[model samples]
Target: MTTVAFIGLGAMGYRMAAHLPQHFDSVLVWNRNVDKAKQHAAEFNTQAVTLAEAAQADIIFSCLPTSHQVDEIIHQVDIKSGAIWIDCTSGVPDIARTQATYLKSKNVSFLDAPVSGQTIGAENATLTFMVGGDAEVFDKALPAMQALGKLIKHVGGSGAGFAVKAVNNMLLAVHLCAAAEGFTTLKAHGVNLNEALDCINASSGKSGVTENVLSQRIFNRSFPNTFALLLLAKDTGIALDLVRDAKLSAPVIALSQSLIQAASATSDADSDFSAAVKMYESWSKITLE
Candidate 1:
Protein backbone atom coordinates (compact mmCIF):
# COMPACT_ATOMS: atom_id res chain seq x y z
CA MET A 1 0.00 0.00 0.00
CA THR A 2 1.11 3.56 -0.74
CA THR A 3 2.18 5.78 2.15
CA VAL A 4 0.97 9.37 2.07
CA ALA A 5 1.52 12.75 3.62
CA PHE A 6 -1.19 15.42 3.42
CA ILE A 7 -0.29 19.00 4.29
CA GLY A 8 -2.14 22.26 4.93
CA LEU A 9 -5.05 21.51 7.21
CA GLY A 10 -7.20 24.53 6.62
CA ALA A 11 -10.97 24.21 6.33
CA MET A 12 -10.81 22.28 3.06
CA GLY A 13 -7.53 20.55 3.83
CA TYR A 14 -8.76 19.28 7.21
CA ARG A 15 -11.74 17.59 5.66
CA MET A 16 -9.76 16.40 2.64
CA ALA A 17 -6.97 14.93 4.78
CA ALA A 18 -9.44 13.24 7.11
CA HIS A 19 -10.60 11.09 4.20
CA LEU A 20 -7.10 9.94 3.15
CA PRO A 21 -6.26 7.35 5.80
CA GLN A 22 -9.16 5.25 4.65
CA HIS A 23 -7.41 4.81 1.29
CA PHE A 24 -3.73 4.63 2.21
CA ASP A 25 -2.05 2.30 4.68
CA SER A 26 -0.11 5.05 6.44
CA VAL A 27 -1.12 8.68 6.10
CA LEU A 28 0.88 11.31 7.96
CA VAL A 29 0.19 14.98 8.65
CA TRP A 30 2.05 17.98 9.98
CA ASN A 31 0.51 21.38 10.65
CA ARG A 32 2.29 24.51 11.81
CA ASN A 33 0.01 24.23 14.75
CA VAL A 34 0.93 20.93 16.39
CA ASP A 35 -2.24 20.42 18.40
CA LYS A 36 -4.51 20.66 15.39
CA ALA A 37 -2.31 18.21 13.55
CA LYS A 38 -2.43 15.82 16.48
CA GLN A 39 -6.17 16.17 16.75
CA HIS A 40 -6.63 15.46 13.05
CA ALA A 41 -4.10 12.64 13.17
CA ALA A 42 -5.98 11.01 16.01
CA GLU A 43 -9.35 11.27 14.29
CA PHE A 44 -8.06 10.17 10.88
CA ASN A 45 -5.84 7.41 12.25
CA THR A 46 -2.74 9.04 10.86
CA GLN A 47 0.51 10.23 12.37
CA ALA A 48 1.29 13.77 13.48
CA VAL A 49 4.88 14.48 12.58
CA THR A 50 7.40 17.06 11.46
CA LEU A 51 7.71 18.42 7.91
CA ALA A 52 10.69 16.20 7.13
CA GLU A 53 8.85 13.14 8.36
CA ALA A 54 5.87 13.99 6.17
CA ALA A 55 8.20 14.59 3.24
CA GLN A 56 9.54 11.03 3.43
CA ALA A 57 6.21 9.57 2.38
CA ASP A 58 5.76 8.12 -1.11
CA ILE A 59 3.04 10.62 -1.98
CA ILE A 60 2.66 14.18 -0.68
CA PHE A 61 -0.55 16.10 -1.23
CA SER A 62 -0.73 19.77 -0.38
CA CYS A 63 -3.91 21.88 -0.08
CA LEU A 64 -2.08 25.09 0.65
CA PRO A 65 -3.64 28.53 0.13
CA THR A 66 -1.21 30.00 -2.42
CA SER A 67 1.38 29.22 -5.04
CA HIS A 68 4.08 30.91 -3.03
CA GLN A 69 3.19 28.80 -0.02
CA VAL A 70 3.43 25.66 -2.10
CA ASP A 71 6.80 26.68 -3.43
CA GLU A 72 8.04 27.67 -0.04
CA ILE A 73 6.88 24.49 1.66
CA ILE A 74 8.38 22.24 -0.99
CA HIS A 75 11.70 24.04 -0.83
CA GLN A 76 11.77 24.28 2.93
CA VAL A 77 10.89 20.69 3.59
CA ASP A 78 13.59 18.05 3.33
CA ILE A 79 11.83 16.00 0.69
CA LYS A 80 13.62 13.16 -1.08
CA SER A 81 13.85 11.45 -4.42
CA GLY A 82 11.15 9.01 -5.63
CA ALA A 83 8.40 10.94 -3.81
CA ILE A 84 5.45 12.27 -5.77
CA TRP A 85 4.42 15.82 -4.87
CA ILE A 86 0.90 16.77 -5.85
CA ASP A 87 0.01 20.38 -5.10
CA CYS A 88 -3.71 21.08 -4.78
CA THR A 89 -3.15 24.81 -4.35
CA SER A 90 -5.12 27.23 -6.55
CA GLY A 91 -2.03 28.98 -7.85
CA VAL A 92 0.19 30.35 -10.58
CA PRO A 93 0.74 28.11 -13.58
CA ASP A 94 4.25 29.21 -14.26
CA ILE A 95 5.21 28.53 -10.68
CA ALA A 96 3.76 25.07 -10.86
CA ARG A 97 5.74 24.31 -13.99
CA THR A 98 8.89 25.60 -12.37
CA GLN A 99 8.29 23.39 -9.35
CA ALA A 100 7.72 20.38 -11.56
CA THR A 101 10.89 21.06 -13.44
CA TYR A 102 12.90 21.49 -10.26
CA LEU A 103 11.52 18.29 -8.78
CA LYS A 104 12.19 16.32 -11.96
CA SER A 105 15.90 17.15 -11.72
CA LYS A 106 16.03 15.38 -8.39
CA ASN A 107 14.23 12.22 -9.62
CA VAL A 108 11.11 13.41 -7.76
CA SER A 109 7.90 13.95 -9.75
CA PHE A 110 5.37 16.74 -9.31
CA LEU A 111 1.79 17.43 -10.32
CA ASP A 112 -0.36 20.48 -9.96
CA ALA A 113 -3.80 19.03 -9.24
CA PRO A 114 -5.93 21.89 -8.01
CA VAL A 115 -9.39 20.87 -6.91
CA SER A 116 -12.94 22.23 -7.11
CA GLY A 117 -16.37 21.59 -5.44
CA GLN A 118 -15.46 23.60 -2.35
CA THR A 119 -15.67 22.52 1.29
CA ILE A 120 -18.92 20.61 0.90
CA GLY A 121 -17.40 18.74 -2.02
CA ALA A 122 -14.27 17.86 -0.07
CA GLU A 123 -16.21 16.55 2.92
CA ASN A 124 -18.51 14.51 0.70
CA ALA A 125 -15.66 13.05 -1.41
CA THR A 126 -17.33 14.45 -4.52
CA LEU A 127 -14.76 17.08 -5.48
CA THR A 128 -13.30 17.44 -8.97
CA PHE A 129 -9.59 17.54 -9.76
CA MET A 130 -7.82 19.14 -12.74
CA VAL A 131 -4.40 17.54 -12.91
CA GLY A 132 -1.31 18.67 -14.79
CA GLY A 133 1.65 16.32 -15.08
CA ASP A 134 3.13 13.48 -17.07
CA ALA A 135 0.73 10.68 -18.05
CA GLU A 136 2.70 8.15 -16.01
CA VAL A 137 2.70 10.40 -12.97
CA PHE A 138 -1.02 11.06 -13.35
CA ASP A 139 -1.76 7.34 -13.52
CA LYS A 140 0.07 6.86 -10.22
CA ALA A 141 -1.75 9.79 -8.60
CA LEU A 142 -5.27 8.90 -9.75
CA PRO A 143 -6.31 6.50 -7.00
CA ALA A 144 -5.31 8.87 -4.17
CA MET A 145 -7.23 11.70 -5.80
CA GLN A 146 -10.23 9.42 -6.30
CA ALA A 147 -10.33 8.96 -2.54
CA LEU A 148 -11.00 12.69 -2.29
CA GLY A 149 -12.83 13.58 -5.51
CA LYS A 150 -15.35 12.07 -7.90
CA LEU A 151 -14.20 13.65 -11.17
CA ILE A 152 -10.48 13.59 -12.00
CA LYS A 153 -8.84 14.58 -15.26
CA HIS A 154 -5.28 14.79 -16.43
CA VAL A 155 -5.73 17.98 -18.41
CA GLY A 156 -2.17 18.31 -19.77
CA GLY A 157 1.50 18.47 -18.80
CA SER A 158 3.21 20.43 -16.03
CA GLY A 159 1.07 23.47 -15.18
CA ALA A 160 -2.26 22.57 -16.78
CA GLY A 161 -4.00 22.22 -13.45
CA PHE A 162 -2.91 25.68 -12.43
CA ALA A 163 -4.06 27.10 -15.78
CA VAL A 164 -7.50 25.54 -15.47
CA LYS A 165 -7.90 26.51 -11.81
CA ALA A 166 -7.00 30.14 -12.52
CA VAL A 167 -9.42 30.38 -15.43
CA ASN A 168 -12.13 28.61 -13.47
CA ASN A 169 -11.71 31.02 -10.53
CA MET A 170 -11.65 34.02 -12.85
CA LEU A 171 -15.04 33.01 -14.19
CA LEU A 172 -16.26 32.40 -10.66
CA ALA A 173 -15.33 35.97 -9.82
CA VAL A 174 -17.31 37.17 -12.81
CA HIS A 175 -20.31 35.05 -11.88
CA LEU A 176 -20.23 36.12 -8.24
CA CYS A 177 -20.19 39.80 -9.14
CA ALA A 178 -22.96 39.27 -11.69
CA ALA A 179 -24.96 37.41 -9.08
CA ALA A 180 -24.46 40.25 -6.62
CA GLU A 181 -25.37 42.89 -9.19
CA GLY A 182 -28.36 40.88 -10.41
CA PHE A 183 -29.69 40.48 -6.91
CA THR A 184 -29.32 44.19 -6.20
CA THR A 185 -30.99 45.07 -9.52
CA LEU A 186 -33.88 42.77 -8.78
CA LYS A 187 -34.27 44.19 -5.30
CA ALA A 188 -34.20 47.73 -6.71
CA HIS A 189 -37.05 46.98 -9.09
CA GLY A 190 -39.06 45.36 -6.26
CA VAL A 191 -38.83 41.94 -7.89
CA ASN A 192 -39.18 39.06 -5.53
CA LEU A 193 -35.73 37.54 -4.98
CA ASN A 194 -36.95 33.99 -4.38
CA GLU A 195 -39.09 34.01 -7.54
CA ALA A 196 -36.30 35.58 -9.58
CA LEU A 197 -33.81 33.00 -8.37
CA ASP A 198 -36.18 30.16 -9.23
CA CYS A 199 -36.71 31.53 -12.74
CA ILE A 200 -33.03 32.29 -13.26
CA ASN A 201 -32.05 28.82 -12.08
CA ALA A 202 -34.52 27.29 -14.47
CA SER A 203 -33.28 29.50 -17.32
CA SER A 204 -30.08 30.96 -18.77
CA GLY A 205 -29.33 33.50 -16.04
CA LYS A 206 -28.07 30.93 -13.59
CA SER A 207 -24.67 29.75 -12.28
CA GLY A 208 -23.10 28.33 -9.14
CA VAL A 209 -23.95 31.66 -7.59
CA THR A 210 -27.67 31.51 -8.30
CA GLU A 211 -28.10 27.79 -7.73
CA ASN A 212 -25.98 27.44 -4.59
CA VAL A 213 -24.55 30.69 -3.20
CA LEU A 214 -27.50 33.10 -3.48
CA SER A 215 -29.92 31.12 -1.35
CA GLN A 216 -27.45 29.61 1.09
CA ARG A 217 -25.24 32.57 1.90
CA ILE A 218 -26.14 35.86 0.24
CA PHE A 219 -29.91 35.85 0.75
CA ASN A 220 -29.61 34.56 4.29
CA ARG A 221 -26.75 37.01 4.96
CA SER A 222 -25.18 34.26 7.06
CA PHE A 223 -21.97 33.92 5.05
CA PRO A 224 -20.92 30.96 7.19
CA ASN A 225 -19.48 29.44 4.06
CA THR A 226 -15.75 28.75 4.53
CA PHE A 227 -14.13 30.05 1.35
CA ALA A 228 -12.06 33.22 1.69
CA LEU A 229 -12.84 36.36 -0.31
CA LEU A 230 -9.18 37.31 -0.03
CA LEU A 231 -8.14 34.08 -1.71
CA LEU A 232 -10.63 34.57 -4.52
CA ALA A 233 -9.36 38.08 -5.10
CA LYS A 234 -5.78 36.84 -5.10
CA ASP A 235 -6.68 34.08 -7.56
CA THR A 236 -8.33 36.62 -9.86
CA GLY A 237 -5.04 38.46 -10.00
CA ILE A 238 -3.24 35.22 -10.91
CA ALA A 239 -5.84 34.47 -13.59
CA LEU A 240 -5.43 37.93 -15.05
CA ASP A 241 -1.69 37.40 -15.12
CA LEU A 242 -2.33 34.36 -17.30
CA VAL A 243 -4.68 36.26 -19.62
CA ARG A 244 -2.36 39.21 -19.96
CA ASP A 245 0.56 36.87 -20.47
CA ALA A 246 -1.37 35.32 -23.34
CA LYS A 247 -2.24 38.85 -24.61
CA LEU A 248 -5.99 38.16 -24.46
CA SER A 249 -8.75 40.75 -24.12
CA ALA A 250 -11.25 40.33 -21.29
CA PRO A 251 -13.05 43.49 -20.20
CA VAL A 252 -15.70 41.82 -18.01
CA ILE A 253 -13.15 39.65 -16.28
CA ALA A 254 -11.08 42.73 -15.53
CA LEU A 255 -14.05 44.53 -13.99
CA SER A 256 -15.08 41.50 -11.95
CA GLN A 257 -11.51 41.16 -10.63
CA SER A 258 -11.56 44.78 -9.50
CA LEU A 259 -14.88 44.36 -7.73
CA ILE A 260 -13.75 41.20 -5.96
CA GLN A 261 -10.44 42.84 -5.02
CA ALA A 262 -12.21 45.89 -3.61
CA ALA A 263 -14.59 43.72 -1.64
CA SER A 264 -11.75 41.63 -0.28
CA ALA A 265 -10.09 44.85 0.80
CA THR A 266 -13.22 46.33 2.42
CA SER A 267 -15.06 43.30 3.78
CA ASP A 268 -13.78 40.69 6.18
CA ALA A 269 -10.93 38.97 4.39
CA ASP A 270 -11.69 35.63 6.05
CA SER A 271 -15.41 35.76 5.30
CA ASP A 272 -16.96 33.49 2.73
CA PHE A 273 -16.55 34.81 -0.81
CA SER A 274 -20.35 35.16 -1.01
CA ALA A 275 -19.72 38.28 1.07
CA ALA A 276 -18.97 39.73 -2.35
CA VAL A 277 -22.66 40.53 -2.33
CA LYS A 278 -21.82 43.16 0.26
CA MET A 279 -20.03 45.15 -2.43
CA TYR A 280 -23.17 45.51 -4.51
CA GLU A 281 -25.27 46.11 -1.43
CA SER A 282 -23.00 48.94 -0.36
CA TRP A 283 -23.19 50.53 -3.77
CA SER A 284 -27.00 50.16 -4.17
CA LYS A 285 -27.75 50.77 -0.50
CA ILE A 286 -30.12 47.77 -0.57
CA THR A 287 -29.28 44.50 1.17
CA LEU A 288 -30.22 41.22 -0.45
CA GLU A 289 -32.18 40.24 2.63
Candidate 2:
Protein backbone atom coordinates (compact mmCIF):
# COMPACT_ATOMS: atom_id res chain seq x y z
CA MET A 1 0.00 0.00 0.00
CA THR A 2 1.43 3.35 -1.01
CA THR A 3 1.26 6.08 1.64
CA VAL A 4 0.10 9.50 0.39
CA ALA A 5 0.87 13.03 1.62
CA PHE A 6 -0.84 16.13 0.29
CA ILE A 7 0.55 19.64 0.73
CA GLY A 8 -1.00 23.10 0.27
CA LEU A 9 -4.68 22.78 0.96
CA GLY A 10 -5.69 25.87 -0.90
CA ALA A 11 -8.97 26.11 -2.89
CA MET A 12 -8.00 23.70 -5.67
CA GLY A 13 -5.55 21.71 -3.59
CA TYR A 14 -8.12 21.05 -0.88
CA ARG A 15 -10.62 19.71 -3.40
CA MET A 16 -7.96 17.68 -5.21
CA ALA A 17 -6.53 16.28 -1.98
CA ALA A 18 -9.96 15.42 -0.60
CA HIS A 19 -10.16 12.54 -3.06
CA LEU A 20 -7.01 10.79 -1.84
CA PRO A 21 -8.71 9.16 1.13
CA GLN A 22 -10.98 7.33 -1.29
CA HIS A 23 -7.91 5.49 -2.60
CA PHE A 24 -5.25 5.61 0.08
CA ASP A 25 -5.40 4.28 3.64
CA SER A 26 -3.45 7.15 5.23
CA VAL A 27 -3.48 10.52 3.46
CA LEU A 28 -1.44 13.06 5.42
CA VAL A 29 -2.35 16.71 4.93
CA TRP A 30 -0.11 19.77 5.26
CA ASN A 31 -0.63 23.47 4.52
CA ARG A 32 1.16 26.70 5.34
CA ASN A 33 -1.89 27.54 7.45
CA VAL A 34 -1.77 25.08 10.31
CA ASP A 35 -5.47 25.53 11.12
CA LYS A 36 -6.53 24.72 7.55
CA ALA A 37 -4.36 21.61 7.54
CA LYS A 38 -5.71 20.47 10.87
CA GLN A 39 -9.32 21.03 9.81
CA HIS A 40 -8.80 19.30 6.47
CA ALA A 41 -7.19 16.31 8.19
CA ALA A 42 -10.06 16.17 10.61
CA GLU A 43 -12.57 16.28 7.81
CA PHE A 44 -10.83 13.44 6.00
CA ASN A 45 -9.90 11.65 9.21
CA THR A 46 -6.20 11.79 8.23
CA GLN A 47 -2.99 13.00 9.82
CA ALA A 48 -2.12 16.69 10.25
CA VAL A 49 1.65 16.90 10.58
CA THR A 50 4.85 18.78 9.82
CA LEU A 51 6.58 19.02 6.46
CA ALA A 52 9.21 16.46 7.50
CA GLU A 53 6.52 14.05 8.63
CA ALA A 54 4.52 14.51 5.43
CA ALA A 55 7.72 14.15 3.39
CA GLN A 56 8.07 10.60 4.68
CA ALA A 57 5.17 9.36 2.56
CA ASP A 58 5.81 7.05 -0.37
CA ILE A 59 4.04 9.54 -2.65
CA ILE A 60 3.45 13.27 -2.16
CA PHE A 61 1.23 15.67 -4.10
CA SER A 62 1.67 19.45 -4.01
CA CYS A 63 -0.64 22.03 -5.58
CA LEU A 64 0.94 25.17 -4.30
CA PRO A 65 0.76 28.74 -5.76
CA THR A 66 4.23 29.31 -7.21
CA SER A 67 7.53 27.68 -8.16
CA HIS A 68 9.36 29.59 -5.42
CA GLN A 69 6.95 28.23 -2.80
CA VAL A 70 7.41 24.74 -4.22
CA ASP A 71 11.19 25.10 -4.06
CA GLU A 72 10.92 26.43 -0.52
CA ILE A 73 8.98 23.33 0.57
CA ILE A 74 11.39 20.98 -1.19
CA HIS A 75 14.31 22.53 0.66
CA GLN A 76 12.50 22.76 4.01
CA VAL A 77 11.29 19.17 4.05
CA ASP A 78 13.28 16.05 4.85
CA ILE A 79 12.27 13.87 1.90
CA LYS A 80 14.49 10.84 1.44
CA SER A 81 15.57 8.88 -1.58
CA GLY A 82 12.87 6.88 -3.38
CA ALA A 83 10.06 9.21 -2.32
CA ILE A 84 8.04 10.46 -5.28
CA TRP A 85 7.05 14.16 -5.29
CA ILE A 86 4.36 15.22 -7.72
CA ASP A 87 3.98 18.99 -8.08
CA CYS A 88 0.73 20.28 -9.57
CA THR A 89 1.88 23.86 -9.32
CA SER A 90 1.31 26.00 -12.42
CA GLY A 91 4.87 27.34 -12.57
CA VAL A 92 7.92 28.23 -14.59
CA PRO A 93 9.33 25.45 -16.81
CA ASP A 94 12.91 26.43 -16.08
CA ILE A 95 12.24 26.30 -12.36
CA ALA A 96 10.50 22.97 -12.74
CA ARG A 97 13.49 21.55 -14.59
CA THR A 98 15.96 22.99 -12.11
CA GLN A 99 14.11 21.47 -9.16
CA ALA A 100 13.35 18.19 -10.89
CA THR A 101 17.01 17.75 -11.78
CA TYR A 102 18.00 18.55 -8.21
CA LEU A 103 15.47 16.06 -6.84
CA LYS A 104 16.70 13.41 -9.30
CA SER A 105 20.24 13.89 -7.98
CA LYS A 106 18.82 13.18 -4.50
CA ASN A 107 17.22 9.97 -5.85
CA VAL A 108 13.74 11.52 -5.30
CA SER A 109 11.40 11.21 -8.25
CA PHE A 110 9.61 14.35 -9.51
CA LEU A 111 6.66 14.91 -11.80
CA ASP A 112 5.61 18.35 -12.96
CA ALA A 113 1.88 17.74 -13.28
CA PRO A 114 0.18 21.13 -13.57
CA VAL A 115 -3.58 21.04 -13.82
CA SER A 116 -6.44 22.90 -15.56
CA GLY A 117 -10.29 23.22 -15.26
CA GLN A 118 -10.27 25.42 -12.13
CA THR A 119 -12.17 24.77 -8.88
CA ILE A 120 -15.32 23.41 -10.51
CA GLY A 121 -13.36 20.67 -12.24
CA ALA A 122 -11.41 19.98 -9.08
CA GLU A 123 -14.56 19.70 -6.96
CA ASN A 124 -16.08 17.39 -9.53
CA ALA A 125 -12.86 15.35 -9.76
CA THR A 126 -12.74 15.95 -13.51
CA LEU A 127 -9.74 18.26 -13.75
CA THR A 128 -7.30 18.05 -16.65
CA PHE A 129 -3.71 17.19 -15.76
CA MET A 130 -0.77 17.94 -18.07
CA VAL A 131 1.93 15.72 -16.56
CA GLY A 132 5.63 15.86 -17.38
CA GLY A 133 8.05 13.22 -16.14
CA ASP A 134 9.61 9.89 -16.98
CA ALA A 135 7.12 7.42 -18.49
CA GLU A 136 7.74 4.78 -15.82
CA VAL A 137 7.09 7.31 -13.05
CA PHE A 138 3.86 8.37 -14.72
CA ASP A 139 2.66 4.78 -14.75
CA LYS A 140 3.49 4.49 -11.06
CA ALA A 141 1.45 7.63 -10.30
CA LEU A 142 -1.49 6.70 -12.54
CA PRO A 143 -3.74 5.23 -9.88
CA ALA A 144 -3.41 8.29 -7.65
CA MET A 145 -3.76 10.56 -10.64
CA GLN A 146 -6.95 8.77 -11.61
CA ALA A 147 -8.36 9.65 -8.23
CA LEU A 148 -7.82 13.39 -8.82
CA GLY A 149 -8.56 14.02 -12.49
CA LYS A 150 -10.36 12.70 -15.54
CA LEU A 151 -8.26 14.03 -18.43
CA ILE A 152 -4.74 12.92 -17.51
CA LYS A 153 -1.92 12.75 -20.02
CA HIS A 154 1.80 12.07 -19.74
CA VAL A 155 2.85 15.09 -21.79
CA GLY A 156 6.67 14.68 -21.79
CA GLY A 157 9.75 14.98 -19.56
CA SER A 158 10.38 17.34 -16.64
CA GLY A 159 8.86 20.82 -17.09
CA ALA A 160 6.66 19.74 -20.00
CA GLY A 161 3.58 19.86 -17.83
CA PHE A 162 4.18 23.50 -16.89
CA ALA A 163 4.85 24.30 -20.53
CA VAL A 164 1.54 22.78 -21.49
CA LYS A 165 -0.16 24.60 -18.63
CA ALA A 166 1.35 27.92 -19.66
CA VAL A 167 0.02 27.43 -23.17
CA ASN A 168 -3.35 26.26 -21.89
CA ASN A 169 -3.74 29.27 -19.62
CA MET A 170 -2.49 31.59 -22.34
CA LEU A 171 -5.29 30.45 -24.61
CA LEU A 172 -7.77 30.75 -21.78
CA ALA A 173 -6.78 34.39 -21.32
CA VAL A 174 -7.16 34.99 -25.05
CA HIS A 175 -10.59 33.39 -25.15
CA LEU A 176 -11.75 35.19 -22.02
CA CYS A 177 -10.52 38.54 -23.21
CA ALA A 178 -12.11 37.88 -26.59
CA ALA A 179 -15.38 37.27 -24.85
CA ALA A 180 -14.95 40.41 -22.79
CA GLU A 181 -14.18 42.48 -25.86
CA GLY A 182 -17.15 41.00 -27.70
CA PHE A 183 -19.55 41.69 -24.87
CA THR A 184 -18.34 45.24 -24.54
CA THR A 185 -18.69 45.78 -28.25
CA LEU A 186 -22.17 44.33 -28.32
CA LYS A 187 -23.33 46.39 -25.38
CA ALA A 188 -21.83 49.56 -26.84
CA HIS A 189 -23.85 48.86 -29.97
CA GLY A 190 -27.03 48.25 -27.88
CA VAL A 191 -27.20 44.48 -28.42
CA ASN A 192 -28.71 42.55 -25.53
CA LEU A 193 -25.93 40.66 -23.74
CA ASN A 194 -27.86 37.47 -23.00
CA GLU A 195 -29.13 37.21 -26.56
CA ALA A 196 -25.64 37.69 -27.96
CA LEU A 197 -24.32 34.86 -25.83
CA ASP A 198 -27.27 32.70 -26.87
CA CYS A 199 -26.32 33.18 -30.52
CA ILE A 200 -22.58 32.96 -29.97
CA ASN A 201 -22.70 29.75 -27.93
CA ALA A 202 -24.74 28.09 -30.63
CA SER A 203 -22.45 29.40 -33.36
CA SER A 204 -18.79 29.20 -34.34
CA GLY A 205 -17.76 31.93 -31.86
CA LYS A 206 -18.37 29.63 -28.89
CA SER A 207 -15.61 28.98 -26.32
CA GLY A 208 -15.22 28.10 -22.66
CA VAL A 209 -15.80 31.73 -21.88
CA THR A 210 -19.09 31.86 -23.76
CA GLU A 211 -20.14 28.47 -22.37
CA ASN A 212 -18.84 28.93 -18.82
CA VAL A 213 -17.47 32.32 -17.75
CA LEU A 214 -20.04 34.59 -19.37
CA SER A 215 -22.99 32.39 -18.52
CA GLN A 216 -21.93 31.36 -15.02
CA ARG A 217 -20.16 34.45 -13.75
CA ILE A 218 -20.80 37.56 -15.83
CA PHE A 219 -24.48 36.95 -16.38
CA ASN A 220 -24.95 36.03 -12.74
CA ARG A 221 -23.37 39.37 -11.79
CA SER A 222 -21.56 37.94 -8.81
CA PHE A 223 -18.27 36.68 -10.25
CA PRO A 224 -17.39 34.74 -7.15
CA ASN A 225 -13.84 33.57 -6.52
CA THR A 226 -13.33 30.54 -8.72
CA PHE A 227 -9.85 31.55 -9.83
CA ALA A 228 -8.18 34.83 -8.91
CA LEU A 229 -7.09 37.62 -11.25
CA LEU A 230 -3.61 37.72 -9.74
CA LEU A 231 -3.17 34.04 -10.56
CA LEU A 232 -4.39 34.55 -14.12
CA ALA A 233 -1.98 37.43 -14.53
CA LYS A 234 0.85 35.22 -13.28
CA ASP A 235 -0.11 32.30 -15.52
CA THR A 236 -0.36 34.57 -18.57
CA GLY A 237 3.05 36.04 -17.75
CA ILE A 238 4.45 32.52 -17.57
CA ALA A 239 3.09 31.87 -21.06
CA LEU A 240 4.54 35.10 -22.33
CA ASP A 241 7.90 34.14 -20.84
CA LEU A 242 7.67 30.76 -22.54
CA VAL A 243 7.14 32.46 -25.89
CA ARG A 244 10.01 34.94 -25.45
CA ASP A 245 12.37 32.28 -24.03
CA ALA A 246 11.63 29.94 -26.93
CA LYS A 247 11.88 32.78 -29.49
CA LEU A 248 8.37 32.17 -30.72
CA SER A 249 6.58 34.80 -32.81
CA ALA A 250 3.22 35.07 -31.00
CA PRO A 251 2.06 38.66 -31.04
CA VAL A 252 -1.46 37.83 -29.87
CA ILE A 253 -0.19 35.94 -26.82
CA ALA A 254 1.94 38.89 -25.83
CA LEU A 255 -1.01 41.24 -26.29
CA SER A 256 -3.26 39.03 -24.19
CA GLN A 257 -0.61 38.87 -21.50
CA SER A 258 -0.47 42.65 -21.40
CA LEU A 259 -4.24 42.95 -21.16
CA ILE A 260 -4.45 40.58 -18.20
CA GLN A 261 -1.38 42.10 -16.59
CA ALA A 262 -2.93 45.53 -16.75
CA ALA A 263 -6.26 44.29 -15.50
CA SER A 264 -4.59 42.46 -12.62
CA ALA A 265 -3.08 45.75 -11.49
CA THR A 266 -6.50 47.32 -11.09
CA SER A 267 -8.56 47.62 -7.89
CA ASP A 268 -10.09 44.17 -8.37
CA ALA A 269 -6.76 42.46 -8.72
CA ASP A 270 -7.81 39.79 -6.24
CA SER A 271 -11.24 39.23 -7.78
CA ASP A 272 -12.33 36.34 -9.98
CA PHE A 273 -10.99 36.41 -13.53
CA SER A 274 -14.56 36.61 -14.80
CA ALA A 275 -14.41 40.02 -13.20
CA ALA A 276 -12.37 41.03 -16.22
CA VAL A 277 -15.69 41.44 -17.94
CA LYS A 278 -16.44 44.17 -15.42
CA MET A 279 -13.15 45.83 -16.17
CA TYR A 280 -13.94 45.65 -19.86
CA GLU A 281 -17.37 47.09 -19.20
CA SER A 282 -15.95 49.97 -17.22
CA TRP A 283 -13.39 50.85 -19.83
CA SER A 284 -15.73 50.48 -22.80
CA LYS A 285 -18.57 52.41 -21.04
CA ILE A 286 -20.83 49.42 -21.65
CA THR A 287 -22.53 46.99 -19.33
CA LEU A 288 -22.96 43.36 -20.22
CA GLU A 289 -25.74 42.82 -17.69
Q: Whose lDDT is greatest here?
A: 1
Against the reference, the lDDT scores of all candidates come to 0.89, 0.89
lDDT of 1 by residue, 87-182 (tens): 999988899899999888878899999999999999999999999999999998888999999999999999899889988988999998888777
Please give the clash total of every predicted structure, in order: 0, 0
**Candidate 2: residue pairs that collide:** none
Q: lDDT tens digits, residues 74-189, model 2? A: 98877967988999999889998899899988899999999898998888899999999899999999888899999999999999999999898889899999888877878778
The pairs that clash in candidate 1 are none
**Candidate 1 positional error at 152, Å:** 0.3
- Which residue runs of candidate 2 sit more than 4 Å off their true CA positions? none
TM-scores of the candidates in the order shown: 0.98, 0.97
Residue 205 of model 2: what lDDT? Answer: 94
Error of 1 at 175 (Å): 0.8
Root-mean-square deviation of every model: 0.9, 1.0
> Candidate 1 — worst ten consecutive residues by lDDT sum?
268-277
